[model samples]
Target: MTISNLQEVKSRITVFGQPMICRGCSHEVFIPYELYINVEKPGIGCLYAHDIAICQNCGEARHFSDPSDFDNEKGIFVWALRQYVC
Candidate 1:
């Protein structure tokens, strides 16, 4: 992605009201939510998904197939646990 495009995407992202604790470092930080658009080639419809989370403290990241599944209590807990173990 070009710098301009990345900047635009970053500006448009919606962050959660409540920050989540970093799974790797336990630091509280807002989890950014964004729609990722993928276009393999012209004429092909774009594929979109909301699926990325990066821990600001430790630089750990997690990806989900579906964005809607993220941030749910169970998912968050599991993610935190996994990070802790890893």
Candidate 2:
């Protein structure tokens, strides 16, 4: 499950939007949680890290690969959950 090339791993999963307002309570504050994917193959290895924003008022969560990606009118986050070996 080791990834040979870091670039080979790609994700196109948009979890949520920026300034993520809690759908439950319309809360603006959120708590961030770190996420990581670990790959272990015969001759390759890779580790990808991401973040998930959780609303403090409503406890809703959204996933994003990069924090900076959230700074936009429409936040589009991608995922790299798959591993590629070379």
Candidate 3:
């Protein structure tokens, strides 16, 4: 929201320079995974599901979760997703 550097303001998508509107409220939101990391709150750490991009207007969240986290090939988030889905 309060961006100081022009270079800092970038597209929200992972690849960068790709803008997309929030599905919930149709409000414009950037998916800049990098910017999100650099500008994160001190204790936020790495981004997660609950930490996905959120709409400023309606609080709709854009899920940027890692699919690997859901792979049975590994545990972690997948185990959590199964518990959540089942």
Top model by lDDT, which number?
2
In candidate 2, list every pair of residues with a backbone clash: 1-40, 1-41, 2-40, 2-41, 11-79
Q: How high is the CA lDDT of each candidate model?
A: 0.40, 0.45, 0.39
Listed per model in order, the count of residue pairs whose N, CA or C atoms clash below 3 Å is: 0, 5, 3
Candidate 3 achieves a global lDDT of 0.39
Count of clashes in candidate 2:
5
lDDT of 1 by residue, 40-63 (tens): 786687876555556555766544
Off by over 4 Å in 1: 1-19, 31-33, 37-43, 63-86
Model 1 TM-score, 2 decimals: 0.36
Better of 2 and 3 by lDDT: 2
- Candidate 2 TM-score over all chains jointly: 0.41
Candidate 1, lDDT over the whole model: 0.40
Kindly indicate the candidate among 2 and 3 with the higher TM-score.
Answer: 2
Rank order (by lDDT, best first):
2, 1, 3
